[model samples]
Target chain A: MVIQDLKVLICDDSMFARKKMNMTISALGINEVFEAADGEEAVAKYKENKPDVVFMDIIMPRITGIEALKQIIEFDPDAKVVMASSVGTQGHLKEALRAGAADFLQKPISDEDTRAILENAAKGVL
Target chain B: MFAQFFGGYLLHKKLVTSEDLTQAFEDKKHTRMRLGVLAINAGLMTADQVEHVNITQQSVDKRFGDLAVELGYVTEEQVDKLLSQQPTEYLLLGQTLVNNGVLSNAQFEQAINDYKTDNELTDSDLEGSKNESLNKLVTEFYHLEEASNARMLTDYVTMMFKNIIRFIDGDFTPLEAIVIREFDAETLIEQRITGTYDAVTCITAEKDVYFEFAKRFAGENFGDITGFENETVGEFLNVVNGLFAVNQSNEGGAELTMTPQQFIQDKKISFEKPAFCIPVVFSFGEVDFIVSTE
Candidate 1:
C-alpha cells in the first residue's frame, strides 16, 4: 500500500499549527486526513477512525501529547504515532516514544519531515 | 518572523543564551525589529533614548516617525523619506548586512526597490511595525474575514503578548483554553467591584490548565494590578472578541460587540448591556495574558 493512500490524524490545539499540518499533509499528497483540536479529540478520533498513523502534538489541553500517545499505545501497541512539538520538549518527546510514538517531528513542521515521518510510519503498518 | 529575525541577531551577538533567546524569540520571533532597537543598534541613538521613546510611544498615540521627530533624533524629512519605502530602516539593515557579506548595499537596494514595485505599495501605505508572529498568530488563529478587525486583533494580541510573555519568561508553548459556559452577569459585576476578579474569572476557566495559567499569572501580578481578572479577562476577551468580530465580518457583520467594562459595583451594572460574556479560556501556562482595549 502506498503511504499517500493511508489515513493520518493531525492533532494540535493551535488552529494555525493544525491548519499547517493539514496543509502539509495535503501537500505531501495524502488524501485521507483527519484533525483534532486537542489530545482528547485526538483520542476520540483515533478510537473512531484508527488512522494508519497519528501525528500528536505535545503540550495540549485535557491530554498532553505524551499522555494521549500512551492512551493510544494502550489501545494498540503497534499503533504508528508521530509526536509533533516545538523545540525543548525533549523529555516529553522521549516519554512519547517510550509510550509508543513511532517518531518525532519538530516544529515548525516542514514538507520533508512530514513526508519522511508519514512514509516511515506507514512502512510499519501497510 | 520577528522571533527568527531577532533570535538570529541576539544569537549572532551571543548576548543571550540559546535557550533564553529561543524562548523570547519563539513568542515574538517575527516581531518586526523595533525602530528603537534598530536605531540604537545602528549607533544612531543611545539605549536610554530608545527606552524613553518607546515609553512615550506607549503613553501617546504617536507614531515612530512622530516620536523620533519630536525628540529631535531625526528630522521630519529623514523619517518622511524612510517612510516612503518598505521596511527600509537603512541604518539598521545596512549595518546588520554590511559586516556580513550575505548581500551588498546595491543588492539590498535592488531588493527593496523590487519589493516595493512588485507589491504595488505606495508611500502612503505604512506597514505596521508589529512582531509578525503575534500578527500572524491572531489573524490565523481567528481566520477572520474582516481585514481591519483582524489587524486590530493582531495589534491587541501583539501588545498583550509583549507584556504577558514576561511572566513565563516568554513561552509560546500552545495550550487549550477550556472556557466554562457558566457565569451570572450580576454576580460577576458584584465580584468585580469587591476585587474578586481573579476568582470570578477562575469560575470561567474551571479546567486544570486554565487554572494553572490563572494562578501563575495572578499569583505574581494580581496585587500589583487591581481589577486584575477583569483586566486579564478583558485581554482574553479581546482575543475571543477579535476572533469573533473577524470571523463574523464575513457573514455581513454578526453585530457581536462587547459592553463589559470595569464596573464600580451595584447600580444594576447596566442590565441593558450585552449579557453574554465569554470566558476565553487559555490552556497554556506559559503564554500569560495582559489587558488590552481596542
Candidate 2:
C-alpha cells in the first residue's frame, strides 16, 4: 500500500500529545487518523477502525497501553501496534514485546521516528 | 545543566537581579564569547590584565586574543586552547552580562571563582554536561545532601532540569527550594510515581505564567482555550516523570510507573510528608515544582 493511504491510530491520554502526533501524522499525508484518550478507548478504536498502524502510550487513566495492545492483538493477530510511550524501561519493553507489540518508541518521539515507523508499516516490514 | 545552576548561583549571591538574569538570558544568544572572558574564566589571565588589554585595544588595532598575547597576559598556546573550546551557555550568559555593563570584568572574575569554588566544580566539570558533575551541582545547589533520599532527589532533580532545558526553555533561573507540608495552588498538575517507591510531583504557576509555559511547550497559540494549559503542562510532567522512571528502572533495577496526571485549580493539596517546593523563574514569570518523597 502507499504510505499516504495507510490509516494510523494514536492512543495517548494527554490531549497535547494526541494533538501533536495527530498533526504530525496528518502532515505525513495520512488522511485517516484515529485518536484515543485512554487505553480502553484505544482498544475500542483499534477494533472499530482496524487502522493499519497504531501508536500507543504506556500510562493512561484506564487500562494501560500494554493492556490495550494485548486486546488488539488478540482481536487481530496481524495487528501492527507500535508502543510509543515515555517509559521504555527494560521491564516495559520486555512486557510489550512479549505481548506482541510490533515496535517500541521512546517518547518525545520526533517526526522522523514517526515517519520511519509509518514507512516501515507501509512496506510491511513492521 | 550547569548553565541553569550557574544562573541560580548568580541570583543567590545577589550578583544580579532576576530582571538582569531575564534580560541576559534573552541577550546571550547574540553575545559572542570574547577571549578576555574565556581567559579570565580559565584562570589564565587576571582581570586587571584583561582590562589592560581592553584599554590597549582602543589605541592598538588588534584582536583580543592577539592583544592579550602581545601584552604577555596569555601565551599563544593558552589563547588557542581557550579559543578552541566551545563556550558553554553559562559563560555566554556571563559574557552578555558583562557586555551589558551589568557586571564588571573584575566582578565577573570574582563571581566565577567563588561559584566554582563553592560548588567544588573543576574546569572539566564546567566544560561538559557530565551526569556526575550535574548530579553534584544539583545536590549542592538544592542542599539535597542533607535529605534522607539524597540519591533519588539528586537523580530526579537532575533529570528534571535536563528535560526542562530539552522540552521547555533553558533560559530559567532555578530559585531556592522551600519545604512545605501543604500548598494552596493557583494552577497545578500533579502526578504520582509508584512501585519501588511512592512519590508525588506537581507543577504549579500563576494563570498567565501557566499559559505562557504551556505555549512554550506546545508551540501553539491555544488562546483562551480552557483546559489546554492543563493538558500541555500535564504532558510535560508526564514526559519528565516517565523518563525518570525509565532511568531508575534501567540504572537501579527499580521498577516504577506513573499514574495519570491530575489537574488542580484553586485547590489546597497537602502531602503526607514535607515536599520540596522548587521555584524556577523564567522570562515570563515564576513556576513552582513540588516533589514529595513518600
Best by TM-score: 2
lDDT of 1 by residue, B202-237 (tens): 123323444345444433334344344444433333
Candidate 1 per-residue lDDT, tens place, A1-126, comes to 677888999987655456556877897778999999778889889999989988887656676777888888898887888877642233444576677777777554567888877777667641
For model 1, the stretches where C-alpha displacement exceeds 4 angstroms are B1-294
Candidate 1 Cα lDDT to native: 0.49
Residue-by-residue lDDT tens digits, candidate 2, B1-294? 787788899889988999999999999989889988998999998899999999999999999889888777878899889989999998999999999998999999999999999999999999888999999999999999998888998999999999999889999999999999999999999999998999999999999999999999998666567689999999999889989999999899999888889999899999999899999999999999999999
For residues A1-126, what per-residue lDDT tens digits would candidate 2 score against the true structure? 889999999999988899888888999888999999999999999888999999999988879999999999999999999999888888889999999999999888898999999999999999
Which sections of candidate 2 miss by over 4 Å? B223-225
**Which candidate achieves the best lDDT against the true structure?**
2
